[model samples]
Target: MKTREYTFFGGIHPRSYKELSNKYPIEEYLPKSQVIIPLQQHIGAPCTPLVKVNDYVKVGQKIGEANGFVSAPVHSSVSGKVVAIEDRPSSSGKLVKSIVIESDGEFNYDDNIKPNEDINNLKPEEIRYIVREAGIVGMGGATFPTMVKLNPPSDKKIDIVILNGAECEPYLTADHRLMLEKPVDIVHGLLAIMKALGASKGYVGIEDNKQDAIKEIRKACKEYEGVEVAVLKTKYPQGSEKHIIKAITGREVPSGKIPAEIGVVVDNVGTAFAIAEAIKYGKPLIERVVTVTGEGIMTPKNLRVKIGTPFRELIEYCGGFKGTPGKVISGGPMMGIAQYSIDVPVIKGTSGILVLPEDMIALKNPKPCIKCARCVDACPMNLLPLFISAYSLKNDFDKCKEYHAVDCIECGSCSYVCPSKRPLVESIRLAKGEILRKGRK
Candidate 1:
């Protein structure tokens, strides 16, 4: 298949450390002692606990019911008794209510876990119901409920569906491994998503660096019409939903708007696989592929991990740390959140666990901006990051809002290109929080 390379306006080519884990096949890991399933894993309201302490819960059993339309339910990843339901540290550095369960080692499945109707016989509403019931979310770190994307406004016409296989984040390769190992399932999941959204076209966007993944997905798409693999230029943040839409379809999502408004919807490759599994075998979003890697890690490997498993267990399973870990982050280095505790449970949005050695961690003070326009030129959203940072530092959030700081994707492109090592993303993120908070008030 002859395909042209596609990319967005501005993105940095960060050194990809994917080689450390991409070559390793996914290993299945069962929680050793317990699993801590959080109540709120998605973008919306937290789910209400359906099971209390000391209650017997089995794998795939719903433990937390979604309290709102925008949220997704949580399921037990192991067959055990609920030990406790209390506040615990999460990947976001916040204390969230979690359901703790001790493992029974049986790994029993719920009785409701059975095959659904064939895809061809399933209606759009049925597909949406299956997705929602399965608790599938955007596995690409956004953690937005999948059902919400499927059910759009009647006025907005969705014509294209894109599966982001472009694992562009540095040192993360779970999506790439999924694309290579489960291309057919990913394609089937894309078809299910298209059928649900009434969309006619589907595209899988893969970065050019992962040639093997591109080839596998392309081969899988041979029998399917309106589904093709769109090769993307390898760059940081290319896996972003908006950027993938822009690269594949040449459509720009408006500022402060969603892709559905632009007649498109983007889902991660892992999310697609989960949808496929749910439709085929009635599996919930319990286990996910996680890349546990970094220079600080002794054995870097991509493993299929169950949700609610502690980070420390995975690290130890990978042979533990090579030396003193300076920082542990969930997701990629650029956009991932740093973790203060390794005991935090892996939530639905947890993509990868990145551990950096002490020597690699640099603590430097921010210098004054030299006004060289590098930040401006490197901003993917075309916003003035330096000015936004300046205004934000001065506590002039009004000025930050005036500069359209809310439009910033916070991809850290500006910070990566800044010569003075300014914390452009951090300041802009603070300004965005204050602006949104004030607006809500």
Candidate 2:
């Protein structure tokens, strides 16, 4: 396929502060003394605990089973005794039932792991089950169950499956590192997804800044048929579902719809890695690579942390903070949550834990709108953020409805572009909550 620069609608040019941690190769994090694994790590229903207190379990044993089709199973990340199955803070600033395991210091792997005999000879349904049992999700923050994504509506007739390699979010280099370090697994995972979806043609979209990643993927996929690598412009929201679809295929998923409706299904690069593992070695998505870096951090390193590892331990594993942290974010600077505490457990979607120094982390009171309209231009969804924020403030749900507040992708572009420092995105989130509630009622 011919290479080209494809792009989508409105997006911002935020300060790409990736240089802080991009220079280092991804290093494995030494297992902490304890890891607290959350039962509900993905977008589906919470997984029920299959192990009880004091039960000894291996590193790859399934501790939590999905409650339904929407959920993914949870696994133990270390060989140890089950300490407790109780409520613990997740990275999203909420508490959920977690299975805390005390590590035995000796990281032991299950003895049954083996490479697949022949992936092509396996049935498609078998591949889907491997992906589902693997507990994989859209590692790019959506955390939607990957099996559900691969199994779009039979009526949808998806024509394209796109691999999103764009680590568009600044200060997060997990995907970039995965692309560069584990390109083979990534390619295999992409093929596994293609087999699961039965998608004849697929594309890998990587930003220009990650030229090394693009090069790696291109080289890995040279022998594979029906897969092409496409380079995209380095932009903030390039990894967003709709933005990625538009960038590669020039297809617009209409408002109030999913990419499946447009005959496309976008999967994250990391999710592909998990699929590769599930299909090849029968491994599940119990753990992932995480980037723990920021100005307040003593050392910025990419770690392979267990799914339920405590956010505090992950920080301490990196030699603790160099300076006092003013802002502790769970994901990226733009879309990550300003964590209330370090005690939260890292979930599957936990890409990076950024702890900015007191001086580096800036926050100011929301100022009165100056009608600058900078937010209007930055919104990738093309919704009027200022108008939505205004309607939301007035408690005028209908007016907010008129402004399409529900359609906001929450990419943080509006807040990023607002010179007046208006909290347009936060107000819109409130409107979204009210709208969804009312709709449910």
Whole-model lDDT values for every prediction: 0.93, 0.85
Model 2 lDDT per residue over 1-441, tens place: 866777777897777778877777887665667888888877869999999999998877888888888998888888889988899888877788999899897868766545554578878788888787778888988899998987888888877889999889989988898899999888888887778778888888999888888888999999999897888888879989889998888889898898999888899999998888877777778778899998889888888877767788888877898877898999999889999989887789999999989998657678889888888888888888999999898999889988899899889899887887887888899999999999999
Model 1 misplaced stretches (Cα beyond 4 Å) = none
Which structure among the candidates has the greatest TM-score? 1
lDDT of 1: 0.93
What lDDT tens digits, residue by residue, belong to model 1 across residues 1-441?
Answer: 867999988788889999899999888999999999989999998999999889988889988998888999999999999999999999989999999999998999989889998789999999999999989999999999999999998999999999999989999999989998999999999999999999999999999999999999999999999999999999878988889998889999998899999999999999999999999999999999999999999999988999999999999999999999999999999999999999999887888999999999988578889999988877778889999999999999999999999998889999988878898999999999999999999
Q: What is candidate 1's CA lDDT for residue 314?
A: 98
RMSD of each: 0.9, 1.6
How many clashing residue pairs, candidate 1? 0
| TM-score of every candidate | 0.99, 0.97
On the 0 to 100 scale, the lDDT of residue 138 in model 2 is 89
Task: Give the RMSD in angstroms, all C-alphas superposed, for model 1.
Answer: 0.9
